[model samples]
Structure formats: C-alpha cells, structure tokens
Target: MSAARIFAVMVKEFTQLTRDRLTYALILVMPIVQLLLFGYAINNDPHHLPTAVLIQDDSAFARSTLGAIAHTDYFDIVETARTPAELTQAMARGRVQFTITIPGDFTRRVVRGDRAQILVEADASDPSATGAAVAALAGLPQEALKRDLLGAVAPARAAAPPFEVVVHRRYNPEAIAAYNIVPGLLGVILSMTLVMMTALGVTREYERGTMESLLATPVKPIEVMIGKLAPYVLVGLIQTVVILALARVLFDVPMAGGWGVLSVGTMLFIVGSLALGFLLSTVARTQLQAMQMSVFYILPSILLSGFMFPFRGMPDWAQWIGTIIPVTHFLRVVRGALLKGLGFADLWQSLGALSLFVVVVVSLAMARYRTTLD
Candidate 1:
C-alpha cells in the first residue's frame, strides 16, 4: 500500500471517531476502567470470608478458639449457629461462607491434653475462595493458644498442640477445577447467547425496515418487547439442558440439588438476560452497535461473575459492582443448587435479585421503545 493512501484512511477513521464521541470515549477510556476494575478488584487470596460458628462447648477453651478465628482477617464470624441445621441453612442462603463446628468435647479434650478435633465446614463449591483461607488455618491454634496458654494447666508450650483443625471441604472434596467451572459455564453461556440473540433480533428488524411496519400496526411497545423475548425462554431451556448434560457426562460434575429448583432459577436468569438485550437493542441504531454493546456487557459477565475467579476474592467495592450483575447472581444459584443441593430457602435471595433484574430491565426497554413509525 502507498504511504499516502494509508495516511488518508487513518485520517478518515479519526474523523469518524471524533464525530462519534461515545464510541471514541469507550475506545480510549474503557480499557483504563477495565484495568482498574480487574487489577485492584480481583484478589486470588480472599480474606475476611463471612463465617458462622457452631459452639458445642461453653467452656473457656472453646470460647478462646472462636475468638482466635474471629481475630484473623481470614474469617469474619458473622453469627453463632445453634445447630447443624442452622449452619447448613446459612450455607444454602449464602449467608456464611464457612462453618466452624467446635465439638462438645473439644474443650475437655484440650484441657485433658488429649487430641481434640475442630471441624471447619467450607463451602468449597468455589475452591479458589477457600484455598487460601483453609491453608491459613494450620497455625490457628498457635495464635489462639498464645493468649490461652499464658499460664495454662494444659499441655506445655514445647509440646504438640492438643487440637487439630479438621477442614471438611464440602461439595468439592477433591477441589476439582472442573467442578467449579462447569456449573459457572451455564450462566456465562446463557448471558452471551440470550443477550446477543435478542439484541441482534431487534437490530435486524431495524436493518430490514420491518420495525416501521410493525410499529405502524398499533402494537404497543411492551407487547412487541414481550413478543420478541418470549421465544428465548425455550431456547434458554434447551441450552441449559445441553450444558448440564455435557458437564455431567464429560466432567462428572455432580447435581446434588433438585431439578425443579434449578429450572426455576435458570428461567428467571434467562428472562433477565433477554430483558437486558431488549434494553441494549433500544439504544443501538444498528446491528453492529448492538453487537458492540453486547460485547461490552460480556466483559463484566466473564470477569465479575465469579467465572474466571472467586467472587469473594474481589474487594468489597468490586463485589458491590458484581452484585448488580445478573450473571453473578445466576452463578451462585447454579453452583449452590448443583453442588450443595440448595433449595428455595437457600436460593431465594439470588432468585429474587434476578427476578428484580428482569422487571427493571423490561421496564427500561418498554420505556425506551420508540412507538413512532419512521
């Protein structure tokens, strides 16, 4: 190519970019924002994980053990569980990430200089979140005993500590990466397909000039939006079944939860995804712009949805940003249901949030829809 022709093309592209300030801003500023979000937000070594305690013993030693876990930033003891059911419920609700079950005889065994066991139930459905926190527990007693053993009648300082921390990694005993990733793929895939499909569907109507004809037929905006979105629910179901089947057959991923529960949650998430696509369609004048916006949304879906990394590994601010993302909530629903056998009681929070997303996005799409035929 001639140097003069190359320069002319470059100048023409710059002029076009200047005319489209929004696209230019996204090109320049999006990368910087994405870097800050991914760099400062993501943390492989998650800390201060919300935790609950099941105290079986009322003894001083047991109290000391609780304090020691709470003292570290690795575990944030949110509440005390009165029974095993409460702890399980907490796990299902995503209220607590871990459960520290101090057996009833723990204090007695420790005082008697016998081997005592403390069970730490970790929701290892996402192994990365628990890996560092579980590894940090090895020296927990050493930290606890530093205060307790000031003048203890128990085992001396040089002797082996009488307690053993038993970490029971629930749902993912082997810590297989596939077990975590397989379920997450459902949400990621659903978001990508549902959003892009609906966005392209509506944009294609604009490209074909059928939108003006439809708008002239007295069809309400909400009705048109609903009509465009309804077919995608069936499509989402087919995709969900295929992905789940592949996960079970190829990766041996377990589906401990009820099918009914998983189906309902998946439906809500799918509806939300389609609603978002409808919203994006109203903002995009062309199919190409719709595709670009879908890609922009996909970035957050992959990065902030706990698919590429641990959800809790990110800083609190990033997590708050993640909270508003529909895919993030769907990931929790899928993982909790398939891995933990979580029922409505445990998954209602995410399901509710996803439902709200559908409502809000559909409302926005309805409001943004242009009823006038051009």
Candidate 2:
C-alpha cells in the first residue's frame, strides 16, 4: 500500500522488460507494423486492376475506347489476347481482373447505328475489389467514343449510345461476400492455429525441462523438426476439412476446381505454416514469448496476405512485401482452385512459392535449434 513499495515494484518490472529483448522489441515493433499496414498497405478502393483486351478490331474507334477506359485509372490493359481461350486462361490463372472483347465489326456496326457490344468480363471472386472498378464502367459508354464518333458517326453518339458495355461478372456474379471470405478464412485460421500451436508446443518442452531429453537423443536436427511438426500437419488437415465442409454446407461456397489441386495446396500451406512456427520457437525463450512472436507473424499474414483486404489495391511496395508472406500465395491457391477451377498449370507459381517458403523456414529452424543441453 506504500508509495515507496509501489515505485520499487514498477522499477523491477521495467528492469525485467528490458532484459527480455524479444518482448521489449515486440512492444515497440507491433504498433509500427499495425500503423504502416493500416495507413499504407490496406486500401479498399484499388485502381489500375490488370485487364486484358481481345481487340479484334484494329480501328481508331476501338483504341479510343480503350484509352478512355484507361483514363479512369480503374483498368490497366496489360495483355492483348488473340482468342477467347487466351482470355479465359488469363482469368483462370488469376493473371487479369478484367477482360474486354471488342468484336471485329464493332466500328462498322457503331457507324451503321446497329447493335455493337463491348464484352467486359470481370473476375468477381473478390467482389469488393471489383465493385468500384465495375461502377466506373457505367460512364465509359457515353464517354468512350466521343472523339471517334465524330464526322459520319456524330449522329450515333446522339442516339441511345455508340456501343453497349455488357458487364459480365464471372464467378460469384452475385457479389456475395461469403464466397470470398469463407475460402480466405481457411488460410487465416491455418496460419493462426498451426503457427501458434507449433511454437507453443516446442516452447513448452523447454519450460517443462523435457527439451534436455530431446537433446539427449541422437536424432538429426531436421529429423527432430519434422518429427515435432508431423502431428500438427494432421491437425491442420482436419481443420481444413471441417472448415471447407462448413463452407460448402452452410455458406454454399462453390468448389469449382478439382480436389487434387486443393489437397496439394492445403498440404503445402499447412507444412509451411508449421515450419514457420518452428522457426518462431527457436527464437523465443518462453511460451509467452513464442505466443507473442506468433501474433506478430499472424498480423501481417491476415492483413498483407489479402485475407481481409484487396491484394491489388495495396501500393506496389506493400504488394512486394505481401508476396514474401506465404499466406498471400496460399490464399490465391485456395480461392483459385475453389472459385475459378484453376488447374496445376494455372497455379504452378503459387505452389512453387509455398514450397520455397517451407524450405526456407525449415532450414532456418534447423540452424536455430540447439544441439546440446547447454
């Protein structure tokens, strides 16, 4: 109850905090990470989404329309697809958010006052990302051909409109939030649970003095790491099954892709997450420190991984950082396989990224793991 006793206790706590360098660093670093992510990385209104154009008409009018759409800062026509198959592959692979098909006779039809339609196909898997961009398309019909519809085509502009912009929202056409969220939740949940559980389980061994027995065993470091993580892999798979089942039954989330692709992706992500957790266990001295480290890792995984925010909406630098996190690639795999029916050919890069993450994390964990009781 005394003032002197209270002051002494506070001084002791400050000393203890300073001694625990990892905890002290987390205290300062966590807030900065949160601030940077929210302030710079997280953007609801993403612009310049990658778009592909199947320009069958090599006319001045078609180019003018594209120029007008690009001027809005909503779509960036990155690819020129020669055929419908090319455009379909791009969308399936998560390469482009939108595809515009300008028919060969579009300019001819527009000048004749006949029906001319510009097909705008959007990958609406994550509807929030597509909503603003789709909304921007409304005015393109009125403004797109303003300059091109001059001279002989002047009367066409004054009519109903020069050409029709037929917006087809592909995959989750209804803009259902649950369709996007449920699949992403699988990654977020696995990242949180697998990482935290593995870190804590290993750290617990040290606290209970069981780590000495583990050190006494002549098992190789890689062997020990794999042995410890093997059980958690099963746990992760079980969780994935449960979540996906609920997603199908309750949320009606479509599983458009093959089970084989999803299975490979799920296994890769689970092992990668457990490997990261093992890495955290090596750095943290106590169970509490391990838990704190897991949270630090999970925060960025949830935010930068596109689990909660629009991935393409993030600035270039932020997107670069997001690419380094495993969950970012895994989310693509899950969402792609389930929603778009993307095959191995379409998702090879993401699968490769997950494999690289597992290798890097497991190597780091092996190097950090202590060989002796000392």
Candidate 3:
C-alpha cells in the first residue's frame, strides 16, 4: 500500500472512532480501572478482617489472648458478646467476618496443663478470603501466653501454653470450592446473561432498521421500553429457577433460608439487571458497543463484588465501588440465604440497595429512550 493511502485510512478511522465518544472515553478509562484494581485494590494476602468475640469466661488468659489477636493485622475485633447466638446473627447479616469464642473452662484447663481450646469460627463462604487469616491463628496462644504469664503459677508459663486453637469454618464447613462457587454462580450467571441479553434490545431494533416503523406505530416510549424489557425479565426468572434447582440437586449446595425470600431477591436482582441492560442499550449506538459497554460494567462486578475475592478482603475504596453494583448486593442475598439460613430482616439492606439500583437505572432508561426514529 502507498504511504499516502495508509495515512488517509488512518485519519478516517480516527475520525469515526472520535465521533463515538462513549467508546473513546471507555477505551481511555479501562486502563485506569485496571491500574487501580491491580495496584491498590487487589491484595491476595488480606488482613484486618472484621472479627467478633464471644468471651463467656471473662478470664485473664482470655483477655490476654484477645489483646494478642487485636495486635495481629489478621483480625479486627468489631463486636464482643457472651452468647453464640448473638455472634451467629451478626455473621448471618454479614456484619462480622469472623467469631472467636473463649470457653468458660479456658483458664482452668490452661492452669492444669490440659489442652484448652479457643474456638475460632470463620465465615468460609469464600475460602480464599479466610485462608490467610485462619492460617495466622496457629501460634497465637503460645505467643500470647509467653507475654501474659510471666509470674503465673506453672502451666500458664509453660513454653507452650496448654491452650490450643480450634478452628471452625462456618457455612462451607468442608471448605469445598463448589459449595461456595455455586451460590456465587447464581449471581455471575445471571449478571452475564441478563445484562447482555437486554443490552441488545434497542441496538437489535436499530440494526434491523425497524426503529422507524416501530416509532410510527401508536406506542409511547415508556410502553415500548417496557415491552422490550418484560420478556427478558421472565427469561431471567426462569433461568433463576433452573439454576437454583441444579445447584441444589447437582451441587448439593444447601438452601438454608426460606423459598419466599430467595424468590423475592431473585426477582429484584433480575429486574435491576434488565434495567441496567436497557440503560446500556440506550447509550450504545451499535450492538457491538452495547456488548462492550455491558462487559465494561460486568468485569468490575465479578472482580470486586466479592465473587472472586472476599467481600471483606477488598480495600475500602474498592468495596465502596462494589456497593453501587447490583450484583454485589444480590450475591450477599444469595449467599446469606443459601449458606447461612438468613431471613428477610437480616437481608433487607441488600434487597433495598438492589431495588434502588433498579429505580435509578429504569429512570435513566426512560429519560434516554426517544419516541422519534433517530
């Protein structure tokens, strides 16, 4: 090819690309998103995990051990109570990431050179998130007693304290990856299919050159938008039932919560995802761009919504970004229901966030849809 002809083609291509401002901006923005995700947000070795303590003994050894746990960056004690039920409720609501229980006989056992157990319960829904923090527990009591028991009678000052840590991984007790992944799969699968399917709606109509004829008919923009959305919403719900059944039968992932709660949450999530797709469809001028935009939105949800990583593991800013994603809240609903046996009251904030997402996205789509063929 001649140099002059190559230069002319380059100019024409750049001109076309520049005219598509959304694509142009996204192209620039994705690299920055990547930079933030890699450099600042994505830490494989997570620390300072939220922890709750159940200290039934209120003994000196227990106090010393709790202080030691606080010193380590592995856990941050945010709540303390005397009952297991209280802490379990906190875990069910996702208010706390871990629970440490000091048994009433801890001091007596340690003094007598008996193996005293410190019960540490972890929310192991995402195993990777808890793996590091749990691993850090191996040498805790020994290290704590070495410092705490300088003048104590006998066994308390022994080289290794008679105390041992007993770890209980809650939810996914076996640490089975499938049990965790399957529940999150509900969110991931729904997000991928539902968003992409509806994202193609208006772009499909535009590409087929049927927009003019459709606008010529006596249909309001709101009605036309609803018509485009209704069928996909049904498809989403149908997929939800199929997936939930398969997860139960094939994977044996437990549905610990009520059927009614799961049904309501699935409906809210599907509608929100559909609204998101409709919003994307309104913004994108072509089907390819619609797919691109949806993918842009989808990638961060998968990475930051506590699917691939622990929700508590992510940095504060990344977690803040995740809160805006409907998939993030929806995953909490699914996981809490399926694994923790949580009910509506424990899960209302997440459901409310999803409803708010639908309202905002639907409102934007309504504003963006034009009655004219253009």
Candidate 4:
C-alpha cells in the first residue's frame, strides 16, 4: 500500500470512530471501569453468611461450639430452628445459607466420651460462598475437640484422633473455578463477537447502499434475516467447539454433560445474541453507530454476566441488572451443564429465558427493519 493510501484509510477510520460517541466512550472508559469493578467489587471470600441454628442440646459444650463458630465471623446466626423440617424450609426459601443442627444428645454423647454427630446442610448454588462457609464450619468442632482433648490428655498423644471433620463440597466436589468460569466465558465471547459482527454487517450494507439493492431482489425480510444470521451461527458453533476443546485440553475442564445438550444451549444463546445485533442494526444509521451500540450492550454483558467476576459478590441491584442480559442466562445454562452436569430439568429456566429473549428481540428487529429507507 502507498503512504497516501494508508494515510487516507487511517483518516477515514479515525473519523468513523470519532463519529460514534458510544464506541469512543466505551473504548476509553470500559477498561478503567472494569478494573475498578473487578478489583474492588468482586470478592471470592464468603463472609458473615446467614446461618440458622437448631440447638436441641443447649448445654455448655453445645454453647461453646456455637460460640466458637459465631466468634470466627464466618457464621451469622439469623434464626433458631425448632426442627429439621423448619431448617429445611428456611434453606429452601434462601433465608439461610447454612443450617447447623446440633442433635439433642450432642452434650450427653460428648460428656459420656462417645462420639457426637452434628449435621450441617449448606446451599451450594453459589459454589464459592458455599465452600467458604463449609470450610469455616469444618474447623469449628475440630478446634473445640482439640481444646477438650488437650485438657483430658496431657500434650495429646501422637496418634490421637481428636475429631473427624468430614467436608462434603456440595454440587462440585473438586471446587474448580474453571469449571464455572470457562463455560460462562463461552457465552461472553460469543455475545461480544457475534453481536458486533452482525450489527456492523447490516449497517455496513446500509452505508454502502447495498441493502437497497438486496431488498429490490426477490429476498423476503425473514429470508434476508435468515441468510444474514446463518453464517454467524456457524461461526458461533465453531467458537463454541474451539472453546470447549481448549477448556478440556488446556484447563482439564471436563465435559461432564453431553455435547448435544451444550450444542443446543449454545445455539439458543447465539440466536439471542444475533437477534440483539439485528435489533441494533435496525436502529443504527451507520456502521460506526452499529458498532457503538454493540459495545454499549457488550460491556454490561461482560461485567454483569458473571464472566470475570463472581455473581454473588455483586450487589443486589447489580445482580438484578445482570438478570436482564441474555448472556447472563446463557452463562447460567452453560456453567450448570458443564460444571454440575445439570440436565434439561436443571437448566430449563435459563434455556426458556434465552428462548424468550430471542423471540422478543427478533420480533422487534423485524418490525423495525424497513425495506424502503424513508
């Protein structure tokens, strides 16, 4: 390329970028915003998780154990449950994240030099939160037992079995972060690339006056939409396969669920993303504006979709905002399937949400799309 040609192209590109205020703002502001949000707002550590106590044995030993747990700042005793059924109900309603059920015979068994069993039930929907809570609880009884055992036996024997801590990492036994994040990134990557590509694709045709020529042909609106979406759907599938393969080979991430299920889930996500792009294209007057709209949509999808940050860590308002993004639902489905090996029964809500989004967005785009530019 000649120097003059390169300079002209550069000038055109800079002018295009300058014309799109949203894209310019996103390019300048998104990185800083993401850094601040992810650095300060996202914490993997779970603290002061709400917990219910069912202390049937209200003795010195039970009280001591409860005190130890409470003093550690890990468990906030929100309420007292009278029965296991009540505890279960509380957990199901998400009123309590964990429940400590100290059996009626807890003190009697401990005092009699017999083993005492305390049942701990934790909601593991948010794996990071559940893991931290479980770890804190696991150390409690052991510390209490150590204190008691040391007083009984001088310098505690070398082979002493003080108290057994059985930790059942619910939902995910291994507690792998990649198992959650990798699948979620699939949705994020697809939404970011596919939406931008499609949005710009139609807008570019409009900028070049090619859309008019194309519409003058026999192609119907729906047919045009289909033809435009088809190639990007294939691209989305290719990206999915590459991501899955990389996750498996490089990250040792297991495909715990069937590929068929993943394929369908990914297709739904792509449809939603493409529909969003098409909608943006209908409103955007130029390719630069289309790109800007894509960026405006993508930033929230990345930040709020739980791709780079833990969803539970975000504030209630932020989480509610996240619920509106198509990528958020897609992430839930992908992560649930890939990590938890969740079936259709487990992921039906997410899939249903994506389906609804696709319908709404595509319908709006079709309605807005005019064959004749007025």
All candidates' lDDT scores?
Answer: 0.86, 0.91, 0.85, 0.75
Estimate the TM-score for candidate 4.
0.72
**What would you estimate as the lDDT of candidate 2?**
0.91
lDDT tens digits by residue: candidate 2, 1-374: 89999999999999999998989998998899789776898999999999999999989989999999899999999999999999988888888999999999999999987888899999999999999999998988888888777786799988868888999999999999999999999999999999999998778989999988888888777888888999999999999999999999999999996577788989999999999999898888999999998998888888888888899999999999999999999999999999988878888999999999988998898888888766
Ranking by TM-score: 2, 1, 3, 4
Error of 4 at 167 (Å): 2.3
How many clashing residue pairs, candidate 2? 0
**Overall local distance difference test of candidate 1:** 0.86
Quick one: ranking by lDDT, best first? 2, 1, 3, 4
Q: What lDDT score is found at residue 298 in candidate 1?
A: 91
The TM-scores of all predictions, comma-separated, are 0.94, 0.96, 0.93, 0.72
TM-score preference between candidates 2 and 3, better one = 2
State the lDDT of candidate 1 residue by residue for 140-226, as single tens digits: 866676656546654444456758899998889999989999999999999999999999877789889998788779788878888
Displacement of the residue 194 alpha carbon in candidate 2, Å: 0.5
Q: Of the candidates shown, which would achieve the greatest TM-score relative to the real structure?
A: 2
Off by over 4 Å in 4: 1-41, 48-107, 113-135, 142-165, 258-261
